[model samples]
Structure formats: structure tokens, C-alpha cells
Target chain A: MEVVIGTIAGILTSVSMIPQLIKVLKEKEVENLSWMMIAVLLTGVSLWVVYGIMREEWPIIISNAFSVMVNITLLIAYFLYKEK
Target chain B: MEVVIGTIAGILTSVSMIPQLIKVLKEKEVENLSWMMIAVLLTGVSLWVVYGIMREEWPIIISNAFSVMVNITLLIAYFLYKEK
Candidate 1:
């Protein structure tokens, strides 16, 4: 049950960003996205990574680690497209 | 250290949604949002909440439960605005 629930949580959080991710990619307009927000968010994601590590929770760790990657990609895309 | 990390994780994850939530509420345009997505998301969040309960993880539990509330609200908003 625990594993099942954790898996569900992992999937939920993982897929939650699909819409925004799609929008960002499709529109290629990330100028409205704030740098401060992303910075703060990265910091937060890092902490979650830590939490996952400490707890030995593979689901939490993996999901958050991938999240960091996505967020970084989005941040870079924002910068690259901001002047476009 | 664990507490500190958990707190940071909680805050990071909590604030991460602000931008998206703002966009959805301010624009009142949720037609682009998908019901299947929200349903999947809720199911996932429910699992995370259960994970938090099993682990006695206040940070995870509180954050996800609050997430559920926000998601539900967003879903309702989508439906409401869709009909408008």
C-alpha cells in the first residue's frame, strides 16, 4: 500500500507540469516567466531532493531530480527566448 | 538538518505553483486545461498524501494536501469557465 501510494504521488507530481511544459514549448514565449521565481523554485526542488535522499525514497528523489532538470530547461529556454 | 531541509522543501514546493495558479485565475481561461490531466493529478496527490501519513512526513503531507485543494479548485474553475 505504501509503495502503491508513493507511486501514485510520484506520477501525479511528475505529470502535473505537462500542460505548462507544453505551453512553454508550443508558444515559445517565456518572457512572462520570472527569473526570481525559477531561482526560488530550483532551491526548493533541491531541498526536496535532499528530503528524498534522507528518507531513501526513490519515488520522491527521482521525481524531484527530473523536476530539477525540467525546471532548468525551462529557465534556459526563457532566457534564450526572452530576447527573441 | 533534516527539519531544515524538509522546511525548505515544503516552501519550495508550495510556492512553485504560484505562477501557474496566477495565470489560470487571472486569465480565467482554463479551456486549455484537461480534465483527464486533473483527475490523474488528484489521484497522484492522494497517493502522496497517503505517503506522508505513512511516513509521518508533515512537509510532504501538508504540501500535497494543500496541493489537492488547489488542484480541485482549479479543476472546478476550469469547468466553470469552460461553460462560460
Candidate 2:
């Protein structure tokens, strides 16, 4: 039960950016989204991946690595769509 | 070094939403922000807190609890500032 719960939580946090990505893709709007948030998140999750690697924890590595990718994509979209 | 990296990673992910919250408050703009993303993240982090409690991990508990509070505040701000 604990593992299940942890996995669900991990999955949720990892993919939490999907909705925002969809909104951005559909609306092509990024004015209200903060690149700083994504930048910070990308840094955090990337470190998480490194920590996971150090600890030999696959779940942490996989989940946070996924978050890194999602945040990076979001960051790029923010740059692409934000008003100049 | 591992603990140091992990702590910084935890801190970063925990406070990742602050910039977005600041942006929303300053601009009072949420048109491009997805409540779905925040909602999903809130649920995820809340579950993380639960997982931490079950596992008896203070770091996870404190970090995710902070995330929950920040997310709840952001949710309220989103509702307050969003145009109908």
C-alpha cells in the first residue's frame, strides 16, 4: 500500500505539468506562466535525478527525470510564446 | 555531499511555485496559467506528505507540507484574480 501510494504520488508530481503544457499548446498563450518557476523546478528535479542516481533509487531517478523533461519543454514554450 | 544536494533539491522543488505565485499576484493575471496543473500538483504533494508521514520521514513531510500550503494559497489567488 505504501509503495502504491508513493508511486502514485511520484507519478502525479512528475506529470503535473502536462495540463499546463496542453493549455499552452492549445491556446498558444504563455503570458501568465513564470519561466522562473520552470527554471527552478528544472534545477530541482535535475538535482533530484542526480541524488537518485547517487542513492541507486530507480523510482526517484525516473520520476524526477521525467519532471526535468516536462519543465524543460514548458520553459521552451514559455520563451516561444511570451510577449516580447 | 549527497545529503547537501538532496536538501537543496528538496528546498527547490518545495518552493518552485513561489515565482509563479509572485507573478500572479503582481500581474493579477491567470489567463495563461492552468488551474489543472496546480490542482494536480497540490494533490500529488499532499499525497507525498501522507507518504512521508507513513514512512516517518521529516524532510519529505516538511517539504511537501510547505508545498501544500503554497499551492493552496496559489489556488485561492487564482480564483480571486481570474476573469470570468
Candidate 3:
């Protein structure tokens, strides 16, 4: 039951960003993307990692750590393709 | 310690979305926003709520539920502003 719930949570978190990812990819634009937004999200994700560590919640830690990578990649792409 | 951690977590989660929210608000555009993305995020938050309930984690439950409201508001705005 724990595994199932954790899996569901992970899926939900990972899949949630598909729209923004698709949009940025398709348009090759991120004029609307904000550095602060990305920073805050990264910070939040990092804190989640810390929270998981403090609590020893493997599910939260693993999923959020993975999410950090994905979000970082997106942010990098945002910077790379941003209108100059 | 738990309260502090939970409060930090809640703030992190809530503040994390500020960038997207600001961009959407300032641009008055959500052409890139995806319903699927919002749905997934909402689902994630909802699942988090359930997880909190199961675990009796008030912090997670309250924060996620609040996040659901904020995310729903954003999605509603996205739909409202989307080109018809």
C-alpha cells in the first residue's frame, strides 16, 4: 500500500510538468519563464529533499530529487533558448 | 522541530509557484499552460492530501490542499485567458 501510494505521488509530480515542457519545446520560447520562479522551485525541491532526509521518507526524497533534475533541465533549456 | 519543518515545507511548496503565477499575471497569457499539466499537478496535490490523511500529517494535508486551491485558480485563469 505504501509503495502504491508513493508510486502514485511520484507519477503525479513527474507528469505534472508535461504541459510546460511541451509548450517550451514546441514554441522554443520561454519569454514568460522567470528565473526567480525556477530558483524558488529548486529551493523548494531541495528543501523537500532535506525534509525527507530529516524524516527518512524515501519516497519523498527520491521523487523530489528526480524532479529537481527534470526541473533543472527545463530551466537550462529556458535560459538557452530565451530570446536575446 | 516538526512544526518548523512542516512550516518550512508548506512555505516552500506555496512560494515555489510564484514565478509562474507572476508571469501569467503580468503577461495575461497562458498560451503555453497545459490543462494536462494542471490536471496532473492537481492530482499530485490531491494525492498528497490523501497521503497526509493516511499518515495523519497535518502539515502535508493542509499545505497540499491549499496548493490545490492556488493551482486550480491558476488553471482557471489559464482557461479564461486562453485564446478562444
For each candidate, the alpha-carbon lDDT, in order, equals: 0.72, 0.93, 0.75
Indicate the worst ten consecutive residues by lDDT in candidate 1 chain A.
A30-39
- Cα lDDT of model 2 overall? 0.93
Better of 2 and 3 by lDDT: 2
TM-score, chain A, per candidate?
Answer: 0.75, 0.93, 0.74
On TM-score, the candidate that comes out on top is: 2
Of the candidates shown, which would achieve the greatest lDDT relative to the real structure? 2
Between candidates 2 and 3, the one scoring higher on TM-score is 2
The residue-by-residue lDDT of candidate 1 on B1-84, one tens digit each, is: 887887878777766656655666787776434566567767777788889999998878888898788768767876877788
Better of 1 and 3 by TM-score: 3
Instruction: Between candidates 1 and 2, name the one with more favorable DockQ.
Output: 2
Instruction: Give the alpha carbon lDDT tens digit for every residue of A1-84 in model 2.
Output: 888889899999999999999999889989888899999999999999999999999999999988888888888888888855
Residue-by-residue lDDT tens digits, candidate 3, B44-64: 888888888888888777888
Per-residue CA lDDT of model 2 for B2-83, tens digit only, reads 9999999999999999999999989998998999999999999999999999999999999999999999999999999885
Question: Per the 3 Å backbone cut-off, how many clashing residue pairs does candidate 2 have?
Answer: 0
Highest DockQ, which number? 2
TM-score of each: 0.72, 0.96, 0.83
Candidate order by TM-score, decreasing, is 2, 3, 1
